[model samples]
Target: MQAVLRAACRAAADLLFPRNCVHCAGPVETGSYQYLCPACTRALQFCEPPACKTCGYPYFGSVIAPRECPHCAELEPVFDKGKTLFLAKGPGRSLLHALKYHQGFYILKDLTRMLKETPHFKEFLSGAILVPVPLHPTKLRERGFNQSEHLAHTLLQNSDARAVEPLLLRSEFTHSQTHLDRKDRLQNVKNAFALSATANLMNDTYYILVDDVFTTGSTLNACARTLRTAGVTHLRAVAIGHG
Candidate 1:
């Protein structure tokens, strides 16, 4: 089965327009299979040094808990810890837009590689189960794919960790978070997620909610709160981009 999947991937690569890096738009000469060239791969940034111990937001210069950027201190994220691979600025933002809006699925491999190479990823993810923040049924149908789930699959494939696609589910439909005020964002996503009754996760299992972007983190917070009600003990969150 693995061999077949690999062959299919290779064939798809051949058919989809041969071997070009998605980031730098340069030709890749030698690599197993990826959409990022060596230069682009080198250019991709991972959050490092002096980040929030609770939420993985980066802090420059000093290694102290940043004054809890207005987003964190006000509401307090439900997840015990959170981390992101990119700062949601520069090329990182552009790449995320392409992956989410344009469905540039090929970047999954590169994103996986980035996550694997991230300095503190495994330490932060230790003993935790991955759960991609789910899309509403309406949105899922419209998009035809959940980018979070796609990223989760890539993470699992490249790392020893495992992930569940729908351990957390959206309980209500809400407006997009774009341009919404912080209070409105929280209210819009309130009571918007719930755990599946069939999920056998114990209170002891550390869960990591997965998503593509972490803006105000209202959505992840809502999801974590639902899991808390369901008896999740130590919770964390992971995302590709952070603002």
Candidate 2:
């Protein structure tokens, strides 16, 4: 009965609002939940094996054994491991821009669905709590929502993760890292995050940090350092893309 009621409500919503593709803003087919049209969906490139063991960045060459990428080797990441769903290019990049800057909440449903299908998403998040990389109050007000928090919540729908907890807070507002070099990017986020006063830290609990993209991984690393300082011993991260 509840299922039938939900179907009726969904049908009514389609009639009223009419769902549109989050990627291209085209009309979605009736009863279709794919937030992207078939063309855009096909354009999404899922990260496959032969990636860096530490950061999960896809490797271009053949692989006989798992290895850390040069970046991971040079400066170790604070998190135990990291995973991402897609390469940060083409449709994946456009989708992220739309969702982050254009109020594309509809993309969450399909994005989470894809994240759930990633190779190690389930295994990595199996016994963890979700901790979204936070935005400063100023940025939060401007954007109206934290994309990472939404991603964490959507992922929670299919995982055994305990809950989505915004335990971390941005202590300082920083410039955007979009065009910054690795050194500058790391410097930009330095001392930018801190554990919230209301947070309860469980030393034994695994916390999975969530984010929209991993570029130099500076932001995520900074967040991990703060968590570690606050006595969090086990950490992992998942992102929508590896830029």
> 88, model 2: CA deviation in Å?
2.4
Relative to the true structure, how large is the alpha-carbon lDDT of every model? 0.76, 0.82
Write candidate 1's Cα lDDT for 107-149 as tens digits: 7756766766674775666556789888999999999999998
lDDT of 2 at 192: 99
Best by lDDT: 2
Q: State residue 186's C-alpha deviation in candidate 1, in Å.
A: 0.3
Kindly list the per-residue Cα lDDT of model 2 for residues 113-134, writing each as its tens digit. Answer: 7765673666667879999999
> Would you list the clashing residue pairs of candidate 1?
none
C-alpha RMSD (angstroms) for model 2: 2.6
Candidate 2 lDDT (Cα, whole model)?
0.82
